[model samples]
Target: EFLRNELEDSTPVIIMSTAGNESNVLNAFEMGAGDFVSKPVSPSELLVRVGKLLRQRAN
Candidate 1:
């Protein structure tokens, strides 16, 4: 529902989940997610991913 409403491509969506299976990751991408992070995320890694997305969005 959130994705459906936020399809204007302004806010980049990142999916973070414990159930990080292949199908789930694929589903997120198919639903317009900009990135996906699995459970037990490292702060630095998450920051990097977010920064990368933000940089891409800015460009």
Candidate 2:
């Protein structure tokens, strides 16, 4: 609901979850998520994803 409500906002959202199912992922993207990451997250990968979103927003 928050994602849908804030769809027009400039700030990006990244969904992190242990339950990384296809349905949930698609739903999140459909609702305007910038990225999604599965749990047992790697610090480097998270940083890279965040950096990518930041760069995209900058453009």
Candidate 3:
């Protein structure tokens, strides 16, 4: 996968698909994604996920 090769370390990626499809999310994960967000996403949800990922990286 490109991400697996491109990313130097554990990088977090947030994906927004048209619908809440598991395939896209799974593929991202398989490609070394730290997180995946499906579409119809809320602002609050995005904020939370971003915050969580940042916090996780900080720790």
Candidate 4:
């Protein structure tokens, strides 16, 4: 898998998708995504999530 092979462990993957279903969101989490944002995404919300992830990584 790309996450296992290509991505560094510290890198947080946030999936922004329009599907917004529980199954898809669960799949992303199972595959190592740090956070999931459903589409029609607000830029500010995305930024906040990104900031949270970054802060987590920093810690």
lDDT of each: 0.87, 0.88, 0.79, 0.87
Q: What residue pairs are clashing in model 1?
A: none
TM-score order, best first, reads 2, 4, 1, 3
Name the runs in model 1 displaced over 4 angstroms.
4-9
What's the CA RMSD for each of the models? 1.9, 1.7, 1.9, 1.6
Residue-level lDDT tens digits of model 3 in 6-50: 666666777777765777778877877777877788999999999
Error at 22, model 4, angstroms: 0.6
Residue 3 lDDT, candidate 3, scale 0-100 = 60
Our model 4 lands, by Cα RMSD against the true structure, at 1.6
lDDT score at residue 56, model 1, on the 0-100 scale = 100
- Position 32, candidate 4: lDDT: 85
At residue 31, candidate 4 shows an lDDT of 83
The per-prediction tally of clashing pairs is 0, 0, 0, 0
Candidate 1 has its poorest 10 consecutive residues by lDDT at 1-10
What TM-scores do the predictions have? 0.85, 0.87, 0.76, 0.86
lDDT tens digits by residue: candidate 4, 1-59:
38756764648889989998999999888888899998889999999999999999899
**Positional deviation of residue 37's Cα in model 3 after best superposition, in angstroms:** 1.1
